[model samples]
Target: MDTTAAVPPATVIPHPSTAQGATPVRHNLVSLRRLFWLRWALLGGQAALLVSCEAVAGVILPYSPLLAIFSLQALFNLLTGLRLRQHTGRGARPGDAELMGQLMVDLTALSAILFFTGGATNPFVSFYLPGLAIAAAILPWRHVVALAFYALACYSLMLIEYVPLNLHNPDNAINYHLAGMWLNFVASATMIAVFVSRLSGVLRQRDAELNLAREQLLRDARVEALNDQAAAVAHEIGTPLATLAVIAGELRADAADPRLGATRVSAYLPDLQTMEQQLELCKSILARLRDDHETAAPQRIDAWLDGYVERWQLRHPHARLEANAIGDAAGLPVEAARVGQILTILLDNAARSQLAAGHEQIPLRLAISLDDHGTPPTLTFRVTDRGLGIPPAQRARLGEAPMASMHGGQGIGVYLAQSAAQQMGGRLAWHDHHEGGTVAELRLPAPAPEPLPAAPPPASPLTTNPR
Candidate 1:
C-alpha cells in the first residue's frame, strides 16, 4: 500500500529542467596513487636487476651514478605518494596538467639514468614505451602527442651524446646486450597489450553507465511537467462541467412541466440521457486527475489488474483491447492503484494516437507475466498497441515534460506512466513492438508480504496453579 504523504498539485513548484542530453566525461585519478606505489616496486626491481648483472654476470658497470639516480627516484616517489595519499577521491583530483607534470619528471629521470648507462644502447630504454602508453590512456590526445614529441627529442639527444657502457670483456658484450634487449621487448609488450587494454575497457564501461543514468533523469524531469499541466487543467475544467450540468438539469425540469406537451417531453428524453452520460464522463475524468490513484491497498495484483482492464475498456468503448496473465496470476502482492494508473496512462496515449490516425477501432493488449521461482517474485506488465509509432524527434525527448501537438493534444501520458513505475522501485521503458507498434513495459519490485506475529506462549504450570 502507498504510505507516502499527499503531494499537492505541481503548479506551485517550478518545472524541472530537462536540457541535459548526456553526462559530462569525468577524468578519474584514483589510480594515480597506485601508479606511484608501482613506481616504488619497479625501483626495487631496477636495483636488483643492476646487482644481478654486476655480481652474478661479472659485468663491469658504473654503479655510483646509476645508484644515485635510483636513490633520487625512490625519494621522489616517497614524497609524491605521501602528498597524493590524502586525495583518494575524485573531489581532490589534480587536473591533467598536474598528472602530465609527474609523467614528465619520470621521463627526465629515466633519461638521466639512460645517459649514464649507455645512452640509446641501454636495454632499459624500452621502458619509455610503457610510460608513453600510460600517458595516452589517461591524458587528452593533445597532451599525449606532446609527451610523444618530448620522448622523441630525448632519444635523439641520447644518440648523439652520453656516457658509453663499460664492457670489461668486449668478446661477450654482443651476446649479453642481445639478451637484455629481448627481455625489454617482452616486458614492454606485456604492459601495453594486457594492462592498457584492460584499463581502456573499464573507462568505456563507466561512460556507458553514465550516459544511461543521464537519459533516465531527463525522462523523469519532463514527465513532471505533465503533472503540472494536469493539475492546472483539472482546475479549469470544473467551471465548464458545472455549467453543462446545470443546463441539463434545467432542460429536464422544463420537460417534466405539465405545460409542456407529452410529445415534446418524449423528444427531449433521448437527448437528456445523452447529456447525463456526458456529464458523468466529465466527472470521471476530473476524478482521475484529482486522485493520483494511490488508494489501492496491497492485494493480489493479478485480480486488481483484471478489474482495472474491464473498467478501462468501458471508458473507451470503441477501442479493441485485451488483458492476459502469462503465468500463475494469483497471490502476488502489490499496490494495485498505482500500477493501474500507470497502465491507464499508457493505454490512453495509445488510444488517442490510433484515433488520430483515423482508425475505426483501436486495438491494444495488456499482458502480465509473473515469475515466483526467485525471492520477491517479479512482475512485468507490458502494454502493446498497433497505432502509429512514436516519431523520431520525440523518441529521445519522451517523458521529460508536457509537450503539445498542433492538434490540441497534451503529450504527458507516457511521462506520467514512467513516473508512476519509478515510485514503486521499478522503471518504465518504451520499445518498438515486434508487430509494428509500441510496447510500454512496467517492471516493478513485487510487494513483500508482512511477517506474521508470533503465537502467544502457553501458560506456565506454576502460573496456572496461581490462577
Candidate 2:
C-alpha cells in the first residue's frame, strides 16, 4: 500500500488564507444543493399529482410512459444527491456552469411532464412562472433570461403539440384555467415582490460581506509576509552585529593599557567606549527585531529616565544626556521598554543633527516633568538640541519614514520614534527653536499608582542608636 495514496483528504486542513480564497467556489456548490432540494420537491409533487389524476379521478392517458418519465426524474435526482454527498465531506463546491446545467435539467424535465398531461392547457402550466422567478433569485442574470426564454418556448410548444385531457367542455375549462392563471399570476407577483426580494437582497448582502472579509484577510496576510521578511533580514544581519560587538570590546580593552601614552589613552578610550556602545546597541536592536514580543516589567518613572540617559549617552558621548526631574513623579508607573525606545530615538536624532552640522559636541537637554493641568497626570519629556536647524518645509515631514531630507538619509528613525510615542498615549513634535536648533517634545499619561502604604511610625529617641 502506498502511504501517500492512502492518506485521506479529510485529514488535510488548508490555511485560513487558502480557505478564504476558495469561498466563491464553495458558494457555487451551496447553490447546487439548494437547487437539488427544490428539484426533489418538484419530483415529489409531480408523482402525487399523477397518481391522484389516474387512480382517484379515473382520468388516464398513457400511464406507463408518464410513470417512466417520473422514474427518470427520480433517478437523476438520486445521482445528483450522491454526487453532492461525495463532495460534502471534501468541502468541494460546484461551479456556475454546473449549477446552470442542473437548473436547465429541472426546467426540461418539468417541460416534458407538462407536455404529457395538458401542456399550456394545464393550470399548472403557470408553474413555469414560479420556476422563472426562482431562477432570477439564484442564477446569474444571463441564466435567468435564458431560463425565462426556454420556459416561454416550452409553454408555446405545449399550446400546439401537447395531448389534451378532456376533463371539461370549452366554457368550463377556460373559466377554470383562467382562474388558475389569475391565481398563479398573484403567486408569481408575490414571489417576485416578497420572496425573491428578501432572498436575493440577502444573497447580495452576504456577497458584499464576504468581499470585505476577504480584503481584511488580505491585509493580515500582507502584514505576516512583511514580518517574515523582517525575520530573514534580522538573520542576515546577526552575524555582522556579533562581529562588530567583539571588535569593539577588544578595542575598549586595548585602550585601557597604560603602556600607551596617557594622552593617547585619553584620546581613544571615549571613542572605543562609544564604538562598543554603538555595537552593543546594534546587537540589542537586532535581537529585538528577531523577537519583538518580549514583555518588559514596569519601571519607576525616575529610574527608567536615569537608565535611559546613561545608555543613550554611550551612543553620543559628546552629546549631553541629562534628566532633570521638574515634576512630582515619585510613584508614576512607566512601561520601561516602550519609554526607553522612544527616548532613544529622540536622543539619537538630536545627536545626528549636530554631527551633520560638523559640531564636535552636541548640546542636548532632557527635561522631565508632569503636566498637572490634565485630569490624569501626564509625564512629559522635552529634548532640545543645538544643531543645523530643520528647514521650514521639513517640519511637517519630520517623522515621516520615507521623507527626503537635506541631509541625505531616510527618516525611518524619527518616524518609528514618533509612532512609538503616539502608541503609548504620548505625542511627539518638532519645532525650530526661536534661538537655534530644534526642540522635540513627547508627552505620555502616567500610569495610575497603587494605593500608598500607611505612614511609618516616627522613631522614638530611645530606639535610635547612638553613634
- Model 1: how far is 189 from its true place, Å? 2.4
- Score every model by TM-score: 0.50, 0.47
What would the per-residue lDDT of candidate 2 be over residues 287-323, giving only the tens digit for each residue?
6444544424666655455546665564444566545
Per candidate, the number of residue pairs that clash is: 3, 1
- Write down the worst ten-residue block by lDDT for model 2: 1-10
Per-residue CA lDDT of model 1 for 69-186, tens digit only, reads 8988988888777657655443466568777887888898889988988899887787898989988888899889999899999999999999988776768777878888987888
Q: Which regions of candidate 1 are displaced past 4 Å?
A: 1-27, 218-222, 225-229, 232-236, 245-467
- Each candidate's root-mean-square deviation in Å? 17.3, 15.0
Clashing pairs in 2: 29-94
Candidate 1 lDDT for residue 108: 89
Leading candidate by TM-score:
1
